[model samples]
Target: MTNLGKWTARLAVIVILVLAFVAMLWWDPRPHFERVRQDHVVHFVVFYALMLSLVLSLPKLPVWAIAISLFALSVLLEFVQPYFGRECSLSDILTNLITVAVATFPIWIGKTIRPSDN
Candidate 1:
């Protein structure tokens, strides 16, 4: 594929992932589950998936921009949760950061090891 095609495909994937995340947040079905123990695991999985998606989608994006965007999105979701009968928590924000860091660590290491273009 050409560079343009590859980028377009990547952008499409990113958009789809973002839409899925929004849907999940908007239609949380945790209350229907009988087991509280499982809810925590589900939440962690979903947030981690979002973090991973962000890491994979924003390779060319500036690191600070990516971090700021993730933080803002997390905060927005947390704040919006109240209307959906969910409580916002700092721990969730921290977890999202951790997950993003974990997902991007390998990319960071790879860049560091590669020879500079200059």
Candidate 2:
């Protein structure tokens, strides 16, 4: 397998860190959309990208391990959010877990449709 190098992994981690900091610290001005929870959606999308980035950067690791690790991190971060003055939500944690797992779907699709160099 071709390596994307350690830098891509580092970049992914950096993006996740920055987004998490903003997400946990800022009081969301608009937290919903027509009864759907916006925060939960944000958590889902953000974690999805995070999982993909991590796997792209660390292709040697199993996707299940990455998903589990990132899900745990999401849960741990939620626990830590209260210290930063943000309310923790089990719903959000669940959303994070689900989206992280969904991250593997795109990779699978991409591989299946990817063109052959030969």
Candidate 3:
């Protein structure tokens, strides 16, 4: 695929994933509450996908910027969960950070081992 086409497709996926994340976090809960383990898994998987998508879409952008921006967004979402009648907890934030760290670790390692020319 051409670079433009690839970028467009990646951006579309990122948008869809982000919308799903917001909807899952902000929308009313289902009739049955999810188990704690299930909830953590959901957070981990979604955030991991989000972090990876972001890195792929904006490869030129510094990894730290992407990680920090996503972490901030996660924290903001957690804070707003209570207003949506959902429980807000620190574990969710920690899960998000761990996801960010894991997803971005390779980029960090690559940059360290092979310093950028620019």
lDDT, each prediction? 0.64, 0.73, 0.78
Top-lDDT structure, candidate number: 3
RMSD for all candidates, in order, please. Answer: 4.9, 4.6, 5.0
TM-score of each: 0.58, 0.64, 0.70
- State the local distance difference test value for candidate 2: 0.73
TM-score of 1: 0.58
- Tell me the deviation in Å of residue 55 in model 2: 0.8
lDDT of 3 at 113: 82
Model 1, range 54-79, lDDT digits (tens) per residue? 55565576655665677688789888
lDDT of 2 at 50: 79
lDDT of 2 by residue, 3-109 (tens): 46566667777887678657656546345455347677667667876787777767778777888899889989989988876778788788887797678777767
Better of 2 and 3 by TM-score: 3
**Which tens-of-lDDT digit does each residue in 1-118 have in candidate 3?**
6889887868876785876587468433532355666676777778877777776777788899999999999999989988988777898899999989988898688767853554
In angstroms, give how far residue 20 of model 3 lies from its true place: 7.6
